[model samples]
Target: MTRTEMEARVRELLVDLAPEFEADAIDPDEDLRQQLDIDSMDLHQLATSLFEVYGVDIPESERADLVTLRAIVDWLDAHVSR
Candidate 1:
């Protein structure tokens, strides 16, 4: 998928998981756990939800790379793209 599409999907996954936050307000550079009120469990849930949404299996070892929205986008672009 293209980078724009990947970014959009990441935002969509976040909104789907947590509707309280303004999807548009999410700073791609900001850490979701620290900035978005998402906890560690939320991160795990987010990862699982993202895998379900994108049909891609993000390895457990790479979970550390998903700390921020930008990171998630980069991870998906690198790992999920065909």
Candidate 2:
């Protein structure tokens, strides 16, 4: 998938996981967890959801790379098949 598509998909998943927040308001460069006030479990759920959707496994060692929206999109763009 394209980077824009990946970003949209990620935002959709995030909004589903955290309904209090709006997808469009998410700052791509900000720390998602901090911005959303979500915990690690929420992050795990996001990774799981992404894997289920795109079949891309984000290993625990690389979870740190998923700190921001842009990072998640970039990570998915680099790992996921188009």
Candidate 3:
């Protein structure tokens, strides 16, 4: 997928987990957990959902690497096979 597509997917995932967060207000550079009020459990669910939806593996160790929406989209772009 293109970078734009990846970004949209990540935002969609964030919106799924945090419905209270307005999609338009999401800051790509902001820490998703802090900005969206997503707890560890929510993040865990996100990881699982990503794997299920995208077939991308996000090991527990690398969870820290996906801090923001932009980071997650970029990471997935690099990790996922074309």
Candidate 4:
């Protein structure tokens, strides 16, 4: 998928994972956990969701790289096949 579509999908996943937060208001460069008040469980859920959606497996060792929306989109862009 394109980067724009990846970002939109990420936002949709974020909204599903944390409905209390406004996904559209998220700062792409900010730390997702802090910005959205999400915990490790939520992060794991996000990783799982991404894997299910894009067939990209984000190992536990690399979860830290998923700190921001931009980062997640970039990671998916790099790993996911068109």
On lDDT, the candidate that comes out on top is 2
* Candidate 3 ranges beyond 4 A from true positions: none
lDDT of each: 0.80, 0.89, 0.86, 0.87
Q: Indicate the worst ten consecutive residues by lDDT in candidate 1.
A: 73-82
**Which digits, one per residue and each the tens of the lDDT, describe model 1 over residues 1-82?**
6899888877877876779887788999987877778877777778788778777787889787678899888877877757
Residue ranges of candidate 4 with Cα displaced over 4 Å? none
Candidate 2: where is the Cα deviation over 4 Å? none
Alpha-carbon TM-score of each model against the true structure: 0.84, 0.94, 0.91, 0.93
How high a TM-score does candidate 3 get? 0.91
**Any idea what lDDT model 1 has?**
0.80
lDDT tens string, model 4, 19-65?
98786888999998888989989988988898899888987787788
Per-candidate clashes come to 0, 0, 0, 0
Per-residue lDDT of model 2, residues 8-70, tens digit only: 999999999899999999999999878999898999899899989999899889888779998
Compared with the true structure, what per-residue lDDT tens digits does model 3 show for residues 1-82?
A: 7888878877888899999887778999999878998999899888888899789888778888789988898889888887
Better TM-score candidate (1, 2): 2
Q: Name the top TM-score candidate.
A: 2
Clashing residue pairs for model 2: none
Measured with C-alpha atoms, the lDDT of residue 74 in candidate 2 is 84
**What C-alpha RMSD separates each model from the true structure?**
1.5, 0.8, 1.0, 0.9
